[model samples]
Target: MIGDSGAKSLSEGMTSMHELTHLDLSHNNIGHTGAERLSEVMRSMDGLMFLDLSLNKIGDNGAECLSEGMRSMHGLTHLDLSHINIEDSAAARLSDVMRSMDGLTHLDLSHNNIVDCGAKSLSEVMRSMHGLTHLDLSHNNIGDSGAKSLREGMRSMHGLTHLDISDNKIGDSGAESLSEVMRSMDGLTHLDLSHNNIGDSGA
Candidate 1:
C-alpha cells in the first residue's frame, strides 16, 4: 500500500525502467497532481502488464489523465482502479482508452460509483476485448436495468471466465437476464452475485 505518499516521492527521479511489468500503488492518496505526473512517466513504460491504483483519491480528472497515458501500454493485462471515485464520464474515458488494450484479461472497478451509463459503456467496449477473462464491478449502484444492459453487452464475451457483480442492486429480473446469458458463456467458471436482491426463482 503506497497510501499517503506524495506524488513527488513516488515519481521523483523515477526515470526509464522499461522492464517494469507490475506496479501496485493501492490506497495511495495520489490525487490529480500525482496521477498527472505519474501518467507522464507511465507513457514510456510500455512493458507494464499489471497496475493497481485502488483506494486512491484520483477522480475523473485523474482517470482521464491515466487513460491518455495508458494508450501506449498495449501489454497491460490486468488493471485495478476500485474506489477511485470514477463516475460515468470517467468510465467512458477509460473505456475508450481500453479499446487499445487488446491483451487486458483482468479488470477491477469495484466500489466506484459507476451506474447504468458507465456499466453499459464498459460492457459495449468489453465486447471488443476477446481476451478479457476476469472482471469485478462489485459494490457499485448498478440497478436491474444496468445489470440487464451488462448481460446484453457480455453475451459476446466467450472468453470471460470470472465475474463479480456482488452488492449491486440486482433483483430477480436482473438475475434472470444474467442467468440466461450465462448459458452461452461456456468459459465462465466463477461468478459472485452475493448481496443482491435475487430470490430462489432467479437463482
Candidate 2:
C-alpha cells in the first residue's frame, strides 16, 4: 500500500499532468487527507473521464473531498469507489455532487457500509443521471425502504442497461419494489439480485 503520504505525493505530481484522462489508485492506503490533496488536482482535469479508487479505506471524510473534486470534472463518465468504507453520510455527500453529472455512464459502489439512508441518497441522485448505463450497489446493507427509494429513482433511468444490487439485506418487499421498477425500464439488459432474501412471491 502506498499510504496517504504516497497519495499526497502523487497528487502533487498529478497537478502537472493536464492531459490525463484516466486515474486509478486502487489498493492504495489513501484516506481523507490524501483524498483532499488529490481533489485539488482533480479540479484541474476537466477532461478526465475515468476515476477508480477501489479497495482503499477512504470513509465518509474522503467521500467529502472527492465530492468536491467531482464538481469540476464534468467529463467524467465512469466512477468506481467499491470497498472504501463509505457509509450513509459519504453516500449522501457523493450523491449531492453527482446530481450535475448527467453524462456519467457507469458508477460502482459495491461492498461498503451503505444502509437505507445511503441508498436513499444514491437513489435520489440517480434520478437525474439518465445517461447511466451501469450501476452497482451490491453487498451493502440496504433494506425495503431503500429498495423502494431506489425503485423510484430507477424510473427515470431509462438509459441504464445493467443494474446490480446483489448480496444486500433486501427481502420480499424490496424485491417487489425492484420488480415493479424493472417493468418500466425497457432498456435494462442485465439485473443481478442473487444472494439476497427474495422469495417466490417477489420473484
Name the candidate that leads on TM-score: 2
**Which ranges of candidate 1 are over 4 A from the true structure?**
1-5
Write down the TM-score of every candidate: 0.92, 0.96
TM-score of 2: 0.96
The local lDDT score (0 to 100) that residue 115 gets in candidate 1 is: 87
Instruction: Give the per-residue lDDT of model 2 (tens digit) for 1-203.
Output: 88889989898888788898998999998988988888888888888899999999888898889889889788889999999999999999999988878789999999999999999998898888889999999999999899999998888888889999999989999999988889878888899999988888878
**Candidate 1 lDDT over residue span 1-203, tens digit each:** 44335665667656567788998888868888788888887888899999999999999999999898898899999999999998999999999999889899999999999988898889888877888899999999888888988888788788999999999989999999898888988988999999988988888
Candidate 1 TM-score, C-alpha based? 0.92
Which consecutive 10 residues in model 2 have the weakest lDDT in total? 11-20
Clashes of each: 0, 0
Model 2 C-alpha RMSD to native: 1.1
